[model samples]
Target: MKKVSISLIVISQMLLGLTVSTTVSAAAKPITGVNCNGGFFVRTPDKHIHWIDEETEEHVQVYDKSDDIYAMAQCGTGVVTVFEKQIDGEQQYNAIYSPNCMNIGSEKGLSSHIYQGKEKINKIDAKDGKLEIRFVNNTYLRGETCASVSAGK
Candidate 1:
């Protein structure tokens, strides 16, 4: 009985070692293509649309711009509201920009390629009150961010 117990213990130790080794090996490998340097835009915000720059991490503003911008927050999730424009068109959009907060992972750095073939991305600079919609060849559509201080809210 004692011998059988020792054998079971040894087997368990071997299994544990194998499990640990596999986990370590899997974790050692790096994740690739985790960042979205550029892509296509689906919907562009206009006068009726307002959003918070996840970059600012606070404050909401009307995202009316044309520039090479990245709205990573839009890809994740956030709040949306519908409002009217001067042209009497109904527009729907997030009242605030709560982006997924994309970190420039693994990629070398932001380059012209960052704006390549981009269909839609809303880049916001809360500090400067600037917003931009970026597209091909690092081209952009820009606008002045609305100056509605959060203190008023």
Candidate 2:
């Protein structure tokens, strides 16, 4: 009787563990893209403009006017920004940037170049009061007319 009781308890514990693990995994879905109804602009640290459509997922980069790109990531609404940084004399860092927070990870394989393809932008609606900007492959900034501010008028 003791052996049978121990076995049943162990089995129950195993099943509970499996259920908890499955629930946690299912709760956290990987972010792969964004959807926006208005354009969001990204101005790199070196002053370059990247515009993305509201309803489409697009790649963004941190670059300078001299055409040197430091990092790249895909951005859109409802998606966290995954940034890959490869700057000289600095350790490479890759992570996800949320609207008001950043979660850094050491995952490898981050691209630093814009995908070679035709870029598209559709003015579905006039720019709303909010402007979304992803910077340095590390930060996501949102504000009204923030893109123009970063544009260095």
Candidate 3:
């Protein structure tokens, strides 16, 4: 009876080790690539999005820029693109718009207006060739896009 009790304890320990190993392996999968400049966020080969400051190589997970909207809008013909970065549980944004709003003022720059306050994007609507964004504070910004929004799943 003593030998049988020891064998059962050993078997239980082995099973527990196997369960832990399986859980750790699944959680170890990393994010490969994320492309911030390509209008929509593009994923890299490693499944992680790489956010690098052009001036500084610091790994940035969230970025807010206004210039990106102008460029994407220009390419999409009157469509503006806004990007957001989640920082400390809040959303920071950079608004990009058409050439029509370019050279307006420093206060109206692509990154300025969107980051003016503590707001983050809540929903994205790319329906009927229009891109509509709803903010966390219930404000809405709408733009007409010649191209569609393709966020890679």
Candidate 4:
């Protein structure tokens, strides 16, 4: 069986300037080339959607930001495009758009870098636009594409 799972450690201190870094996964960032809903969490260079393929040094997912709003759900629950990574890898959580409340911040960009300041977890398939994710908590987050969502597949 594929030994995979999601884990996060978020620590906080009430003291001012004592910001404790939370152990979050990199799955919590806006889609690189395509804009989600209508927010530039990460600005796109020019009108084209660029993707840095580490393997072939290729470019472009060939996406048009004009077709934004991939997926939408009512609270901190819904499907998201998870660029999964193997265990002992960089990140593991995939962030998506949800009503960001003061208490519940499920919206993307809540953490600047998704996997920044995070250690690897138990999983496999290090890549973007691929892999599966299982949230430890009851929170809803999944790996899926916009096309499948629209088609109701």
Candidate 2 wrong stretches, greater than 4 Å: 29-117, 120-153
lDDT of 1 by residue, 1-153 (tens): 999999999999999999998776554221222221122112233322223243443422323433322233222222111111222343222122222222221112210112222132334333344444443346554444321211110
State residue 98's C-alpha deviation in candidate 2, in Å: 16
Span of 10 residues, lowest total lDDT, candidate 1: 104-113
Q: What is the C-alpha lDDT of each candidate?
A: 0.31, 0.35, 0.42, 0.29
Candidate 2's C-alpha lDDT?
A: 0.35
lDDT of the structure predicted as candidate 4: 0.29
Best by lDDT: 3
What TM-score quantifies how close candidate 2 is to the native fold?
0.26
Query: Which residue ranges in model 3 land beyond 4 Å of their true spot?
Result: 1-117, 146-153
Summarize candidate 2's per-residue lDDT along 94-148 as a digit string, tens digits: 2232231112121123312111211221111113434454443434444453122
| True-structure RMSD, every candidate | 15.8, 14.0, 11.9, 20.9
In model 1, where do residues sit more than 4 Å from their true spots?
28-153
- Model 4: colliding residue pairs: 25-114, 26-114, 26-115, 27-93, 27-94, 27-95, 28-95, 37-69, 86-124, 87-123
Q: After superposition, how far is residue 3 of candidate 2 from its true place, in Å?
A: 0.4
What's the candidate order when arranged by decreasing lDDT?
A: 3, 2, 1, 4
Evaluated at residue 92, the lDDT of candidate 1 is 20
Per residue, candidate 4 scores C-alpha lDDT tens digits across 86-147 of: 34754443323222211112223331112211232232221243333323443322335211
State candidate 3's TM-score. Answer: 0.31
Looking at model 4, residue 124 earns an lDDT score of 22
Q: What is the lDDT of residue 145 in candidate 3?
A: 54
Report lDDT (Cα) of residue 103, candidate 3: 24
Model 3 whole-model lDDT (C-alpha atoms): 0.42
